[model samples]
Target: MKTKLFFFIFSLFFFLKSNAQCAMCRAVLENEEGQSAAKGINDGIIYLMSIPYILVFGLGFFVYWKYFRKKKVEA
Candidate 1:
């Protein structure tokens, strides 16, 4: 079980470096006339990448507040 979990984690790290680009997109972006489009593409990728992390953090904070925060007892 430990080995399987280790391998799964290792594979995830390997896949993290992979990009979402394809051959056609790469060609067009590389040969484009202006830099604005490439900048837009990079910004879009970053925007999309951040959404999941923001959602997870919000969920974690909610959970902590609901279950872990200390409650005051009524006198």
Candidate 2:
């Protein structure tokens, strides 16, 4: 478990930076003299993409905590 946790943390920090853009967006952004717009678009895309995964993970954690928590026995 410790190894897995360490690996997860290591992997998170060493992820490859992506310049993800659709073909049309890439074409438009590439023509600009400054690449800031392209970078911004890529960042926005990554941000939008991560939202659903975060929500699903949160819900799964809540469900696991609710269902698997220890119950108290009455005296």
Candidate 3:
């Protein structure tokens, strides 16, 4: 389990680069000189994309911790 978790986290850091722009956005940004806007748009897209996964992971962890934690049994 620890190895699986370690590999999962390690694999996350090596994601392939992706172009997240829509067709129209790409067309417009392609004409710009520096291409910084295109990079910014792609970055913003990646940021927005990761948010829901992070939130869901946090919520799931909270639920697991709350419900599955060992409880004390008083004599």
Candidate 4:
């Protein structure tokens, strides 16, 4: 229960601060000129994040397929 509460508060803090900004932060993010750059950077971040998961899943899938095929052939 205590752990749960601590985790909840920790997560809440991060969520609240995730979009943390000052005036310049808001202006830059919202500005037309900065939007493309911001979006491109965000996209790169997403791509970087997604690569590891995609690679892991791809590897797991290949292993699963190989094992299943081998089992069928053995049977």
Ranking by TM-score: 3, 2, 4, 1
Q: Residue 42 lDDT in model 1? A: 62
lDDT computed for candidate 3: 0.82
If the candidates were sorted by their lDDT against the true structure, best first, what order would they fall in? 3, 2, 1, 4
Question: Per-residue alpha-carbon lDDT of model 4 for 11-44, expressed as tens digits?
Answer: 7566543433446755767766637766665556
- What is the C-alpha lDDT profile of model 2 across 22-74, one tens digit per residue? 99999999999989988988989988876897799799989877766634222
| Candidate 3 structure quality by residue, lDDT tens digits, 6-64 | 99777677543666789999999999999998999999998898899889989999987
CA lDDT, every prediction? 0.72, 0.79, 0.82, 0.70
> How do the residues 1-75 of candidate 1 rate in per-residue lDDT, one tens digit apiece?
999889967966765555555577767897988867876776677568768967997998898786655553322
Q: Which ten residues in a row have the lowest lDDT in candidate 1?
A: 66-75
The candidate that achieves the highest TM-score relative to the unseen native structure? 3
Q: What TM-score, computed on C-alpha atoms, does each candidate reach?
A: 0.55, 0.67, 0.69, 0.55
Clashes of each: 0, 0, 0, 0
| Candidate 4 lDDT score at position 23 | 64
Per-residue error (Å), model 3, residue 68: 2.2
